[model samples]
Target: MFEGHDPYLVALSVVIAILGGYTGFGLAARIRGTPGVSHRVLLAGAAGFLAVGIWTMHFIGMLAAPIPADTVYLVLPTIISFLICALVVGISLFFVSIGEPSLRRVISSAILLGVGIASMHYVGMHGLSGNFTMEHDDSMVLLSVLVAIVAAYGGLRAFLARQDGIRLIASSIAFGVAVSGMHYTAMFGGHFVPLSGEGHHHGVSGLAASQQILSIVVAVLCFVIAAGFLLSLVPEPRRRGARDSAGETGALAPETDAAAVDVVSPQRDHAGPAAPRIVSAPLGGLGQPQRPAPVARLPLEGADGTHFIDTANVRSVRADAHYTRVHDGTRERMCPWSISEAEAQLDPSLFVRVHRSHIVAIPHVSFVRKEGDGAVIELDGPSPHRVPVSRAKIAELKARLGLARPHA
Candidate 1:
């Protein structure tokens, strides 16, 4: 069976797999910390590209095989195989994406995706119809599944890492090689026997046969994957603007990029400025030392619509990627604020930055306990939320909590 294989097609199949893996995993990595429509869109796009890549690579590898000349592909099973790959791949990605990812979640997701890859391959193999009986070496089949799972775990781990261009490309190449290896491994384990009669081949109606069709299908899918990969390479527009390190709750104007603030000043009141004129300097220098009111309510996006949670109700704000998540006694919501923004804008008297990623409302602290070099703060909330305090900030946090022991 190996003798008739086209080495060039096999190489091309592997290339396709690598490209797909690169595009898919790269897209999935971006889903972290992003929320709402953007998050959902990225997940879907990642899954789609990954699935297409896997499916395309499998069929192309099949085309490279030394198979019976009269073989025809079944429509239903082929479609089913693709769908199975897509559904399982999507589920696996989502599994690792939600909440805080742990070792168990990553492994479980990898196992699932690996099994799915094996299933798709075998099912696609089963779709083959010709004047032959197929038999597989059970051990080789199992080995292929094992390879799939291990490779999947590696791909997911690479994604979990803080990806730079070099790592992303390297991981993609590794995954592509593993995926292609699984395909050929499974193929080599199976042998087909030609029957004395071609009756079975003739009866195989409602199916398509010919190397031409396979080539066309692979080409079209490759085109789609290439388009998606190129699109993913394009950078997304920056959603937020830069602000001073000092916490300021600045809102953008209705139709412009200029931040607008309502100011009441006596000197400027010779004719109170109505329209938001661009302040050349900080607002404090305009003879109005009174700063804008502290951020009283945190804006959050929920399934229904945008909602505001009173700062008084917020127990903690934890940084998630570029955004922050607010724990408000009852539940957690994603906020548009960065950790620095949250620390700066929140009232200093009520909220304090306990760690680079954490902002805790002092009034909500229920307990404090030391853990190794750092300490843990248990906030009073509907759900038990623990915020880690950096060793450097322990003293300040304790002072604000009134647990600081007086100097000797």
Candidate 2:
């Protein structure tokens, strides 16, 4: 029985897993920041990297084993294994990306991914056709399955984790180790028996039992992962904020990314805050069908149909994660524009930004009074609404309303 495994290949397998995890997770983190086509593309790319990492790790681990020459890999089974992994991974990521990832959803996604990965490994193992028969200890198989599930849990959590730089690196390393550990654990339980009669003929039309070909494939994939890793390390492009009707050039907001997890965009001090969260599957806010530019009427989706509200009727716009809530002198309705986008598109003179999360209209203001360190404006809509104003913007607000103190 062949017992010894190549140390270098084993190490390489782990390294590849880490690289792949980092690249995949990195791409996934940006899924919540971008909109529409870019979002879908990132999702596919992330899933592809993750599945390839898992499949490649399994294959490399197999090569590390001291299996006899002439062992052929069945084409169909090998392909099937990868497809299974990719399908499950994609589904899991998709689930968490849409809406807020509840605890139940996270656990369910983790379990599905874990079971799928284990299935992929065993199926690929079954693809080996040679002069030896393989048997696995039932206990060891269970242990490996458990390990796979646990590792998959970590991976899913990592996807949901705040995708900061250091944390991402840490999660990727932990993920890689756990994944490789499962592969080796199962291998430790496998026993091979030499067969004297004619060997398995299923691989006759499959892979040409050549280690060189396997090596080439692994090398090429590793290069691709490395390239993707480098690209992910680069800074994302800055986004230009929309120009207002007043023709005043708005300050550019930092770029946001869409993601598979409950995502939150970073705060921008200069521009109205960027709260570009990916709230729904395939995204509805920024991903909605294209419509005419919002010059006079701002479209709001209601339960029955799309309602376009007159911008002049807009009393105040409050930030709600990626979307905004508008008080239109009657009722508050959900608007898909981000806070920064609302600031940029709406008339700046009529609608002034008083706080990072609150925008107010001068015409609708019933009263302005001090509130603690900052100030609050009482809006005279049908159902009156009060909006908080930042202390920094109080002077500007006073000037806009002809209430500024005369120069000293």
Candidate 3:
């Protein structure tokens, strides 16, 4: 029966479950669609919040159980359980954050997480000390593990989908249920028997229920607060000018007036048949000045040789740390220049920077598809490729492609 259950501690466990679930899902969302060091740091913080929350909940639940007067928890095993939980959850999040998602990776992450949860539970149980022996129902243990696996998979899928705020909150509730259900069900399956003896000496001094509860609550609160602060540091997307804003489309913006054309005229020198001097003038009376043809030669140098590539043949230019990778329809070559530098040199009418890391040729882009908070540009060639569009750049890209007018 639930003889020793403290309603207050039980309520605290439920609160911990809810907070933990929300923090876990929030971490997953922050980690997705992000790259480099920021992704890694956010993933670590999220894993820490989840693992510590689970461990705290388990220990708090144990403290709520009715036990013999001599019962105590060994310090080392309890500490080990917490470490195991953190390590396992951290590994699972890391696997999910890198590259494209796949079923095999999801299953693998789930198994690792499930095993970690079961191990933490059993190890914590082993930490119990008294003149008593513990036994567990094999069927119940199997069932708990199965629940862990299913719950882990479901949570991962929901978080990875990067749904809206309401869906994320709902998934968090489901996650909380999964975690709490597994814990209480496992507890129900366990039986503790007092040894047949007159008296027993308890060597280890365990904290009183109140002290344990207070310490765990404070620690978990600190962890949650720290995670929240870190997540807040993630930068918001840059704000773009309205589509109707002047100069939004770079060179693609329509001409409002005839551009002044520079025309050179030869002047006869007054002194003794000197070579004719040249003077320049702006030809405003002429019809709209002819637009210059798009620049054709892209000066690039690689290990093989320095050459001028026809800009029309360039499919994309990707920023690669200190250098840029210039991709043609058939192959890619590394140039010593940065992407921004190349962007300045390229014809704005033919190419546009779609993301911080990428610039695509307008002619090569076949279509654009929205995904999550961003969009992807599909390029047409022998081998089609997709390039990510930054949230801030989406409007600008549309304007460049003549798909939408600039908005305020």
Candidate 4:
């Protein structure tokens, strides 16, 4: 029984509502940067559904259809509808910021949702052109609310599905298709019309309904296809260099059992080279192998019982420690020490720690020899092992051996 309404205004209102919802939802998704397309697609679908729902509700209410003057109505329904729609839009944004969500997200979403509801109510109120009353019919309103809730659930599920077995792109496409279907189906049942003015009021009917239905189906199909396209662009997870979850490469995966681990200081390879190698231990009596030499202890004692240590406590073995030991026609090199100790006896000019275990005798050293790996100690001593300084005695070795300090 409606008449004299502008069809253009009615259509424009719906378009604006949809745009607002779409913009709000998509903005949230972009901000979230969630790992998959499902979240983005869900947000897009939610925006569309919310826009259509709000637009239909407001437009129908604004139609001012004939009602009994005595019919009682409460403002609560409008409030509830707006609140629900706003909440749907707000949560859509929440799903986007999935990584370590900040407290600000909650606050901002609440504020945005509140504003949306208020704006919807005002827009609906202003669209009314004549005196009319809303009826108190719980069934229809409840049905609408339930449908919106279902739509929301579907949207949430679609977003969450990305975390499950579903492929990211597939989840997004599925969500989009579902949202499009739900939106169009809900819109089809809405009793909507134009705002009354110079033109007679009418909405989708006959060919218009057919066209709208076709458009909705196409839109939904497009949404699903677009979601698939977007998902294809997501990057695949990379394999970590040393980690293996399934032992796929035939190597044993490291156990994830340790809750706490130690951080050992980096060892200085001054006594020897940094390269890892295999060395056999000296054979003991009765052809038994001697235990491998223990790493030279730090804070070593010099023959003269002098203490010489690096200020930083970086331990190094002397060069003499690397000399070969021969026994029973078998010759074996001593366990290597770090560079600082190696330099103590090897480079006479550079190495001057002169004493027992103090290879660098500064006074005895006349010149220094530098090598790429480390410097070699130069001394007049016929015994090489006797000249290598220990980690603790380099300074004493230098002082006794009459060595000059190397240039910085």
Candidate 5:
């Protein structure tokens, strides 16, 4: 079984395994919390990378084996095997992406993915034809499938769990080993038998080994590029940073609402940064509204570092779980503070709480629209930022924006 094992080709297969594992991890990152067409497109790209990478590795290993001169592979069966691997992987990724993270779901996805991998291996083996016939040890075959299942499960857990870079790298290495191990183990369990043939018979015509490898490499590259492009389309969450005055650890400070004061018209000088626009003042003492104060700066924090965001550039702030995401036109950053906390610090005249989890800056708000039982506030920015308004806040939000309440 190991007679024709080429060291260089085996090394190449290992490299492919590593690349596939890393790419799969990246895909998992992009898939989380993503919806609509983007998710589907990214899933497809991931599936292609994983499936093709595995399938190509397997075939390369086979090619490394020193086989009888008369042995040849059928083109049609090989293609079918590739397709089966890709389809199975694609479905597995879809299932994992859509399903909640539970023991049952994880196990089910792992089993499906393992079965696909095993099936692809055997089907590819069936493509081999010539004066020699191949047979596999049933126990070894079962063992290989089991290994695949366990590996797949581990990989899925690592991906679905917290996305730490170090953890992901470790899991990718383990997964690569599992993939390579299964192939070699299955090969170890197989033995070839001589056929009762006399003269050498020509087998089905197919591409040379070099051509096949080149094609597979090209296909994998295309899939990887497509996946990267799709991921790039999804905006990354931004981080806001503020330095502590005492030279302590930097943290995001809750925004303080600006007090009502005399309003000054905003001036936009193309040569410098844009000036903060004056927001409408809230109704004040004796029915005489005070002037709105200008918002100057915002403190933000991110995974990379801290940023003191300019208030003039802020488009909106969205609540995600316990943290708030601040969108500053181009990108968004995660703030350690909650929506309510952040709202309290922001200038009330400029930023209004539309929902328990959402706050929109008045200058960035484009329009408000009634949808279903609630309302949606749209922001003017590079991307559409729609903030949902709770029914209770609908009237207040409309009044603040000076828009007439939509009829029920």
Candidate 6:
């Protein structure tokens, strides 16, 4: 019934609708984690949207005036009303959900809802024939507070449930029930009189009326949808089972055993002798005839005739015409050979550029530290040294160390 109803009544209805809509919408949007919008930003926008939705609902419903004898049509419109209400409210709640719990968000939502309600009521009242001003009685205050509390609780529940799915559903249900209670309580707060004449003037049906029943259903659906969306927002924590097991083993193992394992890898490589080759006899002869004389093993050399230093072993590269000095950690350890000759003898990959002044073994890198002007590279040898990082070489150093994501 739209036309000829008191504007005050329409305003009251709008206010209630707005409050419900704001809270619902805020919770829904927040749990969804809409990017770039912070909690504060959501709250601000929801306040405006809820107010407008509420005002629009009241004004439009008033325009529809009284429906003559077509109660069935009311159901369709009322459903539409509820749908609109749910969407507006859901978005408002969503906004409130992502932000920090604050009086600001709560008060903002409440005030907007209240303003919508008040504005609608007054506007509708202006259209009424009676000379009356809507003065908020004790009932109005109680109703407003009730709406505020329920909406606030709903917003809170949505946020809590977002972290756990089960919790999210539970919170949604709780919020829906709370909202239903608030709606019924507010509807009953209205003051109206009915005519005794047959099929004459009458007031709203009892709380159990079909219209109210439908409202409850709509409210429940709103809660459910909001809860589901919120649950989707939280990310599941990752599992580190393998790493954890490895850590446990390392922690429990003796230090000497760990060291023994470390020493085994290097020794296996250099200590093993080359496999001996069997020579066949003239006639499948003599059970795999005696092996031939071993050929002289040429020295392993790097590109610049540089030899790898396994300091643990006392074997040193010969000081020959090709290379003049033995380079170690302390001195430049002069060598007559060029870089290319040294690289030819050594594994090029193992020895990499650390800085302009040094070429270090990859296995020797312990860590890379960022210093003010340059990076300080630490080596893992028995004796460690900090090498300076030239600005020109920082990018290369970082790439080699895998300290950062690849820039190119």
Tens-place lDDT digits, model 1, residues 1-408: 556789998998898898899899998876764667888888898889889999999999999998987787887788899999999989998887776567899999999999999999999998888788788999999999999998889888877754457879999999999999889999989999777664545356566556677678889998988887788788765433332221123211121222232332222211112112212235454543233457778877543445788899999998655567888875466776666556545777788777766889999999999999989999896566778887767877788888885233
Instruction: Please report how far candidate 6 places residue 49 from its true position, in Å.
Output: 16
Query: What stretches of model 1 exceed 4 Å from their correct place?
Result: 197-202, 238-335, 338-408
Compose the digit string of candidate 4's lDDT tens values, residues 1-408.
Answer: 234334554443344333333333333333232224665565555554444444443533333333222222233443454555556565645533454333355444444543453345443332222233223234533444344444344444333221322333344343333333333333334342434564643232222122234335435533543454345345555432222221122111111211111111133222234323223343455443332332222232212232333312221222222221111111111223333233222333332333222323343344444434334454432322222323334433434444654223
lDDT of 4: 0.35
Tell me the TM-score of each prediction against the true structure: 0.63, 0.61, 0.57, 0.27, 0.57, 0.31
Model 3 poorest ten-residue lDDT run: 263-272
lDDT of 3 by residue, 21-112 (tens): 67776876656434457777778877877787778777777766675656667777877888998899888877876654478998999889
Candidate 2, residues 1-408: lDDT per residue as tens digits? 225889999999999999999998888775654456787898899999999999998898988998878777777888899999999999988887765577899899988998999999999888888777789999989999899889888988888664667879999999999999999988998887777657434335565446667767778888888788888888754343322311121222211111311121233223322222222233466553222233677766443445678888889987655566777875566676767657655665587778777888899999999999889998996568678887777877888789985233
- In candidate 5 the C-alpha lDDT for residue 323 amounts to 56
lDDT of 4 at 22: 37
Q: How close is candidate 5 to the true structure, as a TM-score?
A: 0.57
Question: After superposition on all CA atoms, how large is the RMSD of candidate 3?
Answer: 12.2
Could you say which candidate leads in lDDT? 1
* lDDT tens per residue, model 6, 68-179: 3222213333434434443444444544444343557755654543333433343333333221222334675477445646554554445433223454445545544444
Which candidate tops TM-score? Answer: 1
Q: Is candidate 3 or candidate 6 better by lDDT?
A: 3
Backbone-clash count (model 5): 15
Candidate 5 per-residue lDDT over residues 1-408, each given as its tens digit = 866698988887776776677676667655643446777777887787777678877877876777676565676777888898889778777776763456788889899888888888888888887767788999999998998888778777766654445767788788878988888888888998876666745455664233355446545654664465356446555433221121111112211222322322221111112223334554656553455443467656532345577877788877654455778865456565555445545677687766655678888888788998889887887665677777776776776777755334
Model 2 misplaced stretches (Cα beyond 4 Å): 1-3, 197-209, 239-408
TM-score-sorted candidate list, best first: 1, 2, 5, 3, 6, 4
Instruction: Score each candidate by Cα lDDT.
Output: 0.77, 0.75, 0.67, 0.35, 0.67, 0.40
Model 3, TM vs. native:
0.57
lDDT winner between 2 and 5, please give it. 2
